[model samples]
Target: MVNSTQVSYFTLTAYFDTGRLKHLYFLVVLTLYILIISSNVLLIVVISVNRSLHEPMYMFLCSLFVNELYGSSGLFPFLLIQILSDVHTVSAPLCFLQVFCLHSYGGVEFFTLAIMSYDRYLAICYPLHYNIRMTSNKIAVLTAVLWVYPFLSNVFLVFVLTVPLQLCGNLINKVYCDNYYIVKLACSDTTVNNICGLVKMFTVILGLIVLIIYTYIRILKVCFSGSKQTRQKVFSTCTPHLASLLNFSFGAFFEIVQSRFNLSRLPNMLRIFLSLYWLTCQPLVNPVLYGLKMSKIRNACKDLLFGRKIYL
Candidate 1:
C-alpha cells in the first residue's frame, strides 16, 4: 500500500513473477511494437511519395501515423527496457515526466482525430470547396495547433508534480506511469491537480466527441441527398476514419474509468490486465485497423513492401 507521509523516495518495480508468462508478455509486446513501427512508418513514407494520395484524407492519415509513432515511442521503449531488465522502479521526477509525455501525446492525438473528422465532413459535404478550405495554410495551422496545445497542457500539469508526495510504496500497479496513480501517492493536497486533470480531460475528449459527432451528422445528411453511387463512395471513404475514431474512443473511455474507479476488490493481476488493455492493446491496434480497412493505405503498403517506386 502507498501512503502519503514517507520521506525517502520509494521505488516501484513491476515484474512478471510467472516465468513463462514473463517471457510470453515480453515477446508479445515486442512483436506488437515492431508491427506498429513498421506499419506506421510505411504509411508515412507511402503518403509522402505517392502523389495520388497527397490529398486531404491521406494527409490526415499521415498525421495520424505520425501521432501513433510518437505515442508508441513514448510508451513502449521504456516498458521494453523495464521488462527486459526486470525492474519497475522509477524516480519521482522521472515518473512525472512520463506522465507528462503520455498525456501530452494523448491530447494531441485526440485533437488531430477531431481535425480529421472535420476534413472528412468538408470533403463529403462541400467537395467543391474542400480543396480551398483545407489548403496548405489551413492544414499547417491545424497541425501547428496539434503540436502546441498538448505542450501547453503538459506545462500546466507539471505544476501538479511540484506538490510533495510521500511515496511509501513505489509499486505502480499499472504497466506504465499514470498521472492519477502518481497523484494518489502525493502527500500534499491534490485537489487542484485533480481539478486540472478533469478540466484537461473534458477539454480534449468531450470537445472532440462533440466535434466528431457533428461532422458525422453533417456527412450523413450530405450522403442522403446524393446519388446511390456517390453515397456509397462517401461511405467507403469515411469507413476508415470511423473505425479509427471508435478505437480511440473505446480505449480512452476505459482508461478514464479504470483511473477513476477503485478496483481494490479485484486481484492485482486482473487490474493490471485491464489497464494494459488501453495502454498496450489499443495503441497496437490503431495502425493495424487503418492498414486493414483503408484501401488507399493498403495499396501504399503494398508498393512499399514490394519495392515499387512511390511517385509523389
Candidate 2:
C-alpha cells in the first residue's frame, strides 16, 4: 500500500460472499458446465462423422460449437476452483489468458454468425450459383479467418495494449477477467488503449452486426418473393441463426453497457448475472436450438444414436 508496484493477483469481488451457498452454487455451475460440454461435443461429433452433414452450414455450426466449449472451458474450471477454494483470486497471467479466450470467443461468435448469415443469403437468394460461390475451399478459408482473426486481435489487445499498463489496484469487481476492467484499474492514462479498443470493437462487432442485418434483409426479401417450398426452406435454416443471434446480442448488450458505466445501484447478483449471461447462455442454447429446430441435424443425430435411418 505504500507505493505502486506490479500486481500479481486480482481478487474477484462479484461472487457471493456467503459461504453457506457455495456448495449449492458449485453444484449448479458444475451441472451446467457438464450439460454445456456434453451438448456441444455431441453436436460436434454428429456433424463431424455424418458425411451428409458435411456441408458449409454444418461445418460452420461445428466450429461454433467447438468455440463455445473453448470459451466455457476457459472460465468454468477456474470458477469451480474458486467456488471450492477459500480465496477468489486469479494470477495476472491466468487472468489475461481468460480475457483472451472469452473475448476471442465473443469475437469469433459474431464473425462466424456473420459468415453463417452470408451462407444463408447465398443459398436462399442465389440457389443456382450458391455451390460455386460457396465452395469447400472458400468455406474452409472463411472458417480459418473466423478463428484466427479474433485470436490475433485479442492477442494484440492483451499483450501490446494491456501488458504495458500500470495498474493501481488488483481487485476486479466482476466474476471474470475483462479487458475493460483491467484498463479501468490502470494507474496511468489509458487514452490510447481506450481508443484502440473502441475502434477494434466497432470494426469487428459492429461490422458483423451490419453484415447480419443486410444478409437477413436480403433473405427476407427473397423469401417473400419465392415459392412456398423456398419460404419453408429459408425459415427452417434461418430461424435457428436468428434465435442464437438475438440471445447472444441481448446478453452482450447488457454486459457491454454495464461495463462501460458505473452501475453501482444495481444489485450485485444482477451485475454478476449480466456479466456472465452470454458465457452461460450461448454455449448451452446454440446446440439445443440447432439440434431440435433443424430437421436435418435432428434426424442425423437420431440416426447416429440409433444406428439406423430414422426418417430417410
Candidate 3:
C-alpha cells in the first residue's frame, strides 16, 4: 500500500503584481462581489415576498440566483482575503471546500437552466395541463434534486479520488484551488480520477445541454405555430435564458481552452481573467438580465425599490 501524505496549504496566484496598484485591484474586486451579492439577494427577496411571483418559472429563476450566490461566495471571500494579504495561501480543507462549492455551482447551474427550459416548454406548449404537470410539490422536488445531485457527485469525487492521493506540490498556479489543479499535484496515478471526472462531466454538463436543446426545439415549434401574442410571450421568457446560456457557455469554453492548450505566452492577468470570467460575470448578469428583460420581474423590482405598484 502507498503511504499518503497531505498538503497543509496551497499558494494561489494573486490577480496582479504586488505593487501600489494591488489596493486598487482589491477595491474593484470587492465592489464587484458586493454587487453580485446585493443583486442576487434582491431578486431572491422579490420572488419570495411577492405572491404573484411565486410560479414555477420564478421558482426556478430563484434557484438560479441562489446558486449563483452560492458559487460566488465560494470564491469571493477567499479572493478578498488574498487581495488584502501579503501571501496568497489557503488551507487545504478550505481549498477542498471551495472546489466543492464551485464545481457544484456549475453543475447546479446547468441543471437549473435545463429545468427552466422545461418549465417554459410545458407552460407554452401544454397550457391546459401546465398546472397539472408542474405542481408545487413537483417543482420543489426538482429544485432539491438539482442542488443535491451536484453536491453528492462532488462528494464522491473528492472523497474517493482526491482525498487518497499523495500530493507532490502545493503551489496552485491559479487564484483559487481548482480540482484539476489539485489532481495535478498527486503523485499517484490519476487515470481513475480522470475517467471519473469525465463521466461526471458528461452526465451533469453535457446531459443538461442536450435536454435544454430538446426542450427549446419543442417550444420553438409551438411558438411558430401559435398567434403573434404567443410568439411574443415565448420570446420574452426565453431571451434571458438563451443570453445567459451563451454568456456562461463562452466562459466555460475559455476554461476548457486554457486547460487543453498552451496559451502561456498570454499575459498572466489575461489568462486569469479568462479563467474566471464566468464566476465574475454570471452572478451579476443573471439578475440584471431577468430584472430588466422580464416585465413582471422588472415591474416587481421597480415596485420594491420605488414603492409604486405596477400590475402585470
Candidate 4:
C-alpha cells in the first residue's frame, strides 16, 4: 500500500537485535577480518620481494590476493559499521556503488580463477612453452582484461537495468548491498534486471566452471602421463590453488542461489551470519589454506615473520 513517493523517502535499516550473540558475532568477524588483511598483505609483500615467486602462477596468486582484499574491504567495513552502530542505512548512490564494487570484484575473481586454471594447464600440459605462454606481458594483458571486463559488465548492468527502477521497499533483505536485493526493492517491474542478473551469473559461474574443469582434466592427464616424481610435484603445486578454487566456487554458488530465493522470512541475524560467512569467511579461508597447505608460502611466511630471508 506504500506509494512510490513514500518508498523514495524510506530507507532500509539493520541492527543486531540478539542479546549476547551480536557481540560474539562482531568479535569473531572482526578478528577474522584482521587476519585476512594481515595475511593477504603479507602474501603480497612476500611475493613481491621474493624473486622466485615472479612466475605466472604466483603472479596470478598475488592478483587473487589483491582482489580478495578489495572484495573484503568493500563488504566488511560497512558490515562492521552496521553491526557496531546498529544502523544499516545506506544512501541510494552509496548502495549502488557497493553493488558495483561487489559485482566488479566478483566478476574479476571469476576471470582470475579461470586464468589461474589456464596457467596450471600450461605449466603441467605444456611445460616447455609455459614460460613463453605466460610471460610478463601476457600476464599483464590477462590481468588487465580480467579487471576491465568486469568493470564494464557492472557498468552496463547498472545503466541498462538498475537505473530505470523505481524504488518501492528500500529495505535490502541481505546485510550488504546486492544486485538482486536492490532490484527486488524496485517499485517497477524488474524482469529485465532479474534476467540480466541470471544471465550474468550463469555465464560467469557455469561457463567458467566448465572451463576450469576442462583445464584441470587436461592437467590431470598430463600429470599422470609423466613420471611419478613429476606427478607428485605437480599435485603438490596445485593442491593449494585447488582448495582456493573450491572455496571460491562454493561461496559464489551460495550467493547466487540465495539471491534467487526469496528468503526474507529468515531472521535478520541469520541473514547477517550468512552474509558474513559468504563474503568474509571465503576470503579468509584462502590465506589460511594457502599458508598451511603450501610449503613454499608457509616457509616464506615463517622466514618473513622471523626476520630471516629465505632464498628462493
What is the C-alpha lDDT profile of model 2 across 1-312, one tens digit per residue? Answer: 211236878898887666789899899999999999999998998888878888999999999999999999988998898888788899988998899999899889988889999999999889899999999899989999999999998899888888778887888888888888888888787898989877977887778889999999999999899899989989999999999999999999999888988888998888888898989999999999999999988988888788875333
Instruction: Name the better of 1 and 2 by TM-score.
Output: 2
Per-residue lDDT of candidate 3, residues 1-312 (tens digit): 232235778888535566887788889999999999999999998898788998999999999999999999998888888878888888888888888888889888878888888898899889999999999899989999999998898898876678788887887888987888888878788999998878877776777888888989999998899899989989998999989988988998998787668888998888989889978898889999999999988889989899765333
Off by over 4 Å in 2: 1-5, 309-312
Cα lDDT computed for each candidate against the true fold: 0.75, 0.88, 0.86, 0.78
TM-score (all chains, Cα) for each model: 0.88, 0.95, 0.94, 0.89
lDDT of 4 by residue, 178-249 (tens): 777767677778778778768976887678889899999998887888899999988888888887778777
Q: Which has the better lDDT: candidate 2, or candidate 3?
A: 2
Candidate 3 structure, TM-score to reference:
0.94
**Model 3 residue-pair collision total:** 0
Better of 1 and 3 by TM-score: 3
Residue-level lDDT of model 1, residues 1-312, one tens digit each, is 344434233344435565657667778778989988887887788889889898877877788788878878878887777776655676666666777778787777788889989999898888898888889988889888988988787877764343355454555667788767767666556777777768866877678789999999999988898899989888788887787777777777777777789877877777666666655654567677777877877887898789887684
The candidate, 1 or 3, that scores higher on lDDT is: 3
TM-score of 4: 0.89
Cα lDDT over the full model 3: 0.86
